[model samples]
Target chain A: MEWQNELTRLVKTSYPIVQAPMLGVTTPAMVAAISNAGGLGSLPVGGLSPDQTRSLILQTKALTTKPFAVNLFAHQNSPVNTAQADQMLQFLKKLCAQHQINYPKPDLNSIIFHSYEEQIDILLEENIPVVSFTFGILNKEVIHAFKEKGTVLIGTATYLAEATLLEQNGIDCITAQGMEAGGHRGTFLDSKTLPLIGSFSLIPLVAENCQVPVLAAGGIYNGKTIKAAFTLGAKGVQLGSAFISSNESLAIESYKKSIHDAAETDSVLTKTFSGRWARGIQNKFMMEVENSGLAIPDYPIQNALTTPLRVLAQKQNNKDFTTLWAGQSASKAESKPAGEIFQKLIKETESLP
Target chain B: MEWQNELTRLVKTSYPIVQAPMLGVTTPAMVAAISNAGGLGSLPVGGLSPDQTRSLILQTKALTTKPFAVNLFAHQNSPVNTAQADQMLQFLKKLCAQHQINYPKPDLNSIIFHSYEEQIDILLEENIPVVSFTFGILNKEVIHAFKEKGTVLIGTATYLAEATLLEQNGIDCITAQGMEAGGHRGTFLDSKTLPLIGSFSLIPLVAENCQVPVLAAGGIYNGKTIKAAFTLGAKGVQLGSAFISSNESLAIESYKKSIHDAAETDSVLTKTFSGRWARGIQNKFMMEVENSGLAIPDYPIQNALTTPLRVLAQKQNNKDFTTLWAGQSASKAESKPAGEIFQKLIKETESLP
Candidate 1:
């Protein structure tokens, strides 16, 4: 089987498999391990500050000379609505009290949200070879700057319109994120009604229309699924949940165990944790918030408000309060080293016709 | 490629493809055409009267000597609530008046709700060789009767639990109906929150756990998707939207045209038409009902109220009022004869590795 395709050549990797860049779960060591093992590894800086992003990139660079990608969150910030924020704070307080947990008072004024624009200088300064973004597309100036630096730009799209828009705006590649994908959706066109097109339908449609190569993401955890993506016209495949249980992943033990014990139907799309919709295991916090019928504040704000609860949950090893982010096929995830997982994907794919 | 798998052998078809039995779209001519072309054609009797079902079976048998299957609606009938029905009637009348269409007066008492149990005697009398059902599993007596007649039984499942239930209840085969599937969801375990697992994730999970042969359904149109389904642990593939544009389909010209122009993101799941959630093109009727926020009466009652509107819409060639049921990949459907579609599928699969 021929493995040298446009995607592999563009990423400069031995294979087309990509380790998805998941915030909070991805570590510099995991990214370096995958890149060193001949597949493209992505380091996520979506929630990190400029200094933290630079340090992680440097750490990954020191660990491996192989090319890896850096990821950014390109969502536009919504203006803070004080009334809604206060209501959410009250709701969280009452809920935390019920769970016999301490509620940390969140200062909305003190929360500093980093925009993708602020991270552009760091990427240029670090001389990053590849950059991928989710939640939305980057502005023309940012895209131009990346292209001027000869950086490969990969945009995440959950709809056909978004995919075409990415191509028209000079994006080198598009990652077709399906509904089964873990983490926040990359839908920018119509966020109110999230387009939940699956990979089985999304890949062929995007690949057929877009001039650039399309990488299939969401629910892809093994070689058979990777092969299936290729057969459905995807140039490559990106996997996130498959690495959730990996030894190098920063995910806590309880979070990893929850994924291991989950079934295909266990995960659901919810906006209770963050204003942006994301797939995760159904836990008590999510259910309680959803059943309360309170409107969640927009992204950054809600994410900031829930930080203390999640951190405490992690410290106490309570899986209920933390976001158990995973894809629909999280049950297939195995606890192993990142390099071994990458090698097993290659072996499984090669063994098939 | 060897097409002689357990699925093919059980259905006695040359290829491992099944033409989905879509109510109101599948006709005797279409069923015979697909069966004659070496694929299993399924005739839908879910909405037909016993005599009509018998007549359709005889007509299909006369057209083709090859084996085919008969589909039934195994959903339990919900009791009709008069107040709810009256409210639905008033809503439909207002909608019809706004569209300048005459609203046919529907008599609730005159509406005959047929059960799967009622259709069993018809199937037995007609000596149907193969049987398939959607929405829920059958009782033990029904299964025993089919087994005694040597009829091949196939059950539709939208979740892993449903698939396992079907297997445990003596179902010979299971069709893993993904979220991308057209028409009504076959979910029975917990219908309140529909399971939206994609085929990429659903197929492997169900196949890995169930002892029966699994068939992948939803978003499957061309040879590449068919090949992808097989790679994802599906023994065979069942296609619904692909045959929507066939010459023998009973769908109105306007409905067919809607599917021909639909994109992967055009279709959405809504329960406005039948109380049971179904995927269809976004149109005026679906939008109006959904936006109205009226509580739709359950299956038979809602279906009855909408029947007159759908029929009149078809007569007047109004695409907005009729149900344009289609899968996510309706855009990939080609207008052709049913037999030609089947032949093209075989040729395309054989040409691929």
Candidate 2:
């Protein structure tokens, strides 16, 4: 608890562990479970409609009166290129052909992703205590609005520069998301270039330089790692893939199994799945798409494009085609109740000699 | 001091910090200075003749009475591929044409870098207390010989799998080199694939899983980072670029200046200079070579091929041509005596509440 004073006071949590907001994986039950266990659980509100976001947040609230965070994506939406979109669809057609599935053409109507402003409005309306963001920095007005509501604003940073920017922008906390994290990289600068610094190195640099409290994320799965983070000057630690296999997680059985069966070196970073770098257990879909070297559309577009394949693959329990988002240390994950996992983390950290 | 007991007892150092053996950077003075300051200094004897290696070790011993380590590359020497070598030479020719320098043909007889067997014999004769290796694991017979001689064996691993392999092979210590580290990656597994995992993630995984004691390396610059490594369960820390700017280091004034001028995101991982993945400051040579997409020869060959240009560039103080090896956190390095830097690290760590 020596490392918990500042962060614990800010988040009002017994433990400084923050369950990462993993899209399509973290459920309301998982969020509530982690919060109820005295750790902060974050509901992934990114890419969800305003109404959907509100309902999910409310559901999480109903499950636990304890404080929790709502996560959102603040990425700038790039205009869809028709030509690139067509090429991407054609590439997917070839991928579908290999799997003997039909490739769906781009739905022009579905091009627009969820509006961040609308999500903010919903968060404000519900008076959410904490709000974490990824992809990019929120505008000043948005940040001001959140600050007005006394929201504990957390931002994700892949490099020290991003952490400095977050501190300058009045962010309450910064999550130093190392390159080994699951799902999309939270890098906001020079997005094409891979910074790819590991947590061991990144956390200390971010913690020492950035004035704001640091939340170490990526490849953190157990109590030892949590203790390591606190030692590295992180006020808190955010875990993603480690919680994916928990009973409270909404991940498909196959997804959970994929995480469980993974080896330490199984995770690979690829842009094929979401047109943004993300670490995951390599599968046939990732391999083929990477091998083909086809340029895919940007995020939300690429994310939507691969939805069918992922869904169908999940239904058929075909891990080869599904995106198995996981951190490099997914091998350490245990299939247990999230509350039990939280307790185990606490016990392990406390037991460190 | 709390984290130093196990490592200090094993290595006979007052502190758990180990100065990394950086070829072309670490000098006898630097090694002795670190050892004199109670941190174990390592001599980079990799790819050196037995006579040259012995001279350097003797020089270091003459300067300092403290125990030190000698490092060697244990990579398997593959036969030169004439056709591939020719293609690589041609590609370099094009690069040289741009610089208006006369391209030198391969001295085929100079292909064999050094003999590790002979190097080991010299270490045994010198009664070196510590010997660390990189690139690949040594055979059991070699490891057994070192162990019999009371030489504490440390091996580098980029992944947990490599650490397991090192432990199974009876290594006494494991230096978990994260991807953010400068210099050539120590990965011996699938050499072609870049396992660019950060230190935050890599160290904890290696420390928790590996039975042998772990030494965390890469992107560690100061006392805070040293403390962070211990938190990650490292018995010690091996720092390379952190000492690059130290007065005792052999790095040129320009090279030291480059390290001092770099930002957190300035360093990049490239296989251009050595055809082996190493993190360094982005230079004209690296940028052009990467852009060319030309297949380069393996390490030692490509490293030798660029030596002349680098030498001339260094003499001219042109960072554009020289290989400015550095870590992602190179910006933290300060120009000072190695002993002062070491003391600063201890002071910073001690001051931490």
Candidate 3:
């Protein structure tokens, strides 16, 4: 199977597949394993402090000298809305009681976030080869600074407008995030519009409209999906949910097991978990919190508030309370070494008729 | 390009493309024109009286001796809620006043609809060779009756479960309607869930999981999209918006003009026009109605109530008031003979790398 020249040249990988930088799930070892296996492996440093980000980058570098990317959340912290947060907290408390677990009030005032500026400084110091961003776009100065150092920039877009904007901003690559993709939607423009586009629709539009190299992301898995992405004019493919259940992914065993056993219909998009709409396996927390009609805080705040429940659920192995972040194609995912999954993906892509 | 065996055999068409039976648009000439071009042409007979249905079927038969499919809306009528309908009517009245047009009260009690059973009876009596349906599924008895007459059955599904249900009931083919498609969602299940799956994601899932042959729909217009669909495991493709601007289509000049002038980001899903979620180019009606937050009556009722405004809008060449139902790729649609469009699509699909 022939591959797009731009992606191969830009990422300098043997294959066009990318192991997605899943927050809280992908580790340095997993990233290195994939990078060493001929695919670009990404480190998601969205919630990490500057020191931790530096340490992980060094750790990944130490593990593999191959080129890899570091991903960051480019979003500005949303203003804290106490009333809305409290109502959602009340709803969560009820669910916790039902599950026989204690719900602690989140430290709203002490809520801290990783500023992209600090992360960029660390990336610049380390001379990171590739940097990818989600949630929002980075400012012009930061993007310019990274480019001056010969760092490749990749941005995520859920719509054609975002892809066009990213292209206009001189980004090196764009990942078209279809609605079928799990985790937070990479919609940088109007989040209120809600992501209604599928990868099939978004990929072609972005490819046709944008001049930059395009990476198809979302529900893509296996050889057929890779072929479909290329057919849609995407240069490469980035996958998150497919790796969530991988042996190398950092998700809890129960979370991985849930993804393995999930049906295609088991996933749904809900903002109850993180205030930003995300696709994941439907759990009691999602259904009940969503049905409650209670106002929820914005991202980072809602995400931070739910951290306790997620941690407790993991410890107890109560799958009902855990957020099994997965995509519509989660059922198709298999738990295996990241290297094996990467090799299989490449083999399957090459074997397509 | 080689096509799937089951689809080519089932439709008896040289090419693996289906011209979607768009409501109140596709004409007998268009249907016959497509059928004569070696592609399946479908007649949208939904909401018509039994006599009208028979007449249209006869009209199409006279135009094309080749096999074509008769399509119906197999949905149960939503119960009338007078309170909600009244509130929406008032909202419409105010909008009409703002537009300097008089609004008349609809005959609420007399709002009647054509049942699918009667439509099926007409189709069977006419000995239609092939039949397709959207909005909902047909009952076992109706399906059995149609099959007894050697009629081929096609059903629409937005989700995998819907496709499975259709397959279990002995559907001959399934059209996977991704979220990017224009017009009313073919979703028969909870419309409240909102169709979130895209064609790229939905087609593969449905194709991989369901037993019946799959036809990819939504956002497909050009040869590249057709190639992408096939690569994702679709046996054929069903196109609606692509033909909306065709010279053979029955859409008004202004409506067709709007589609021609559309951009990649011009369309949005709104419930204002039909009280059912539908994707179309945004206009004053959509913006105002949505912003009004006024309760709208169930479909058919709302569809009937808004007819006069659409008629006036077309007469005035004001595209804002008309329902320009189009898929996300409507901007790529061309105004040409249906035969020419079908031939081009076939050529493009054949020429794909």
lDDT on C-alpha atoms for all candidate structures:
0.90, 0.84, 0.85
Across B1-353, the per-residue lDDT of candidate 2 in tens digits comes to 57557778889999889999998889999999999999999999988998899999999999999999999999977667667777767777788788876666657567667857779888999999999999998888889898888889989999877888999888889999988788888989873256666787788878879877889888688776777678777888888888998988777887888888877677887888887888888888887877877787788777777777777777677778878889877777788999999999889878876
Question: How do the residues A211-318 of candidate 3 rate in per-residue lDDT, one tens digit apiece?
Answer: 888999887889999888888889999988888877777788888888888766677888887888788888888888877877778888889889898888878877
By DockQ: ranked, best first: 1, 2, 3
Off by over 4 Å in 3: A82-98, B190-192
Report the CA-based lDDT of candidate 2 relative to the real structure. 0.84
User: Which one wins on DockQ?
Assistant: 1
Best by TM-score: 1
Error of 3 at A195 (Å): 4.0
- List the candidate 2 regions with Cα displacement exceeding 4 Å: A102-106, B90-97, B100-106, B109-112
Q: TM-score of chain A for each candidate?
A: 0.98, 0.96, 0.96
DockQ of each: 0.75, 0.58, 0.56
Summed backbone clashes in each candidate are: 0, 5, 0
RMSD of each: 1.2, 2.3, 2.2
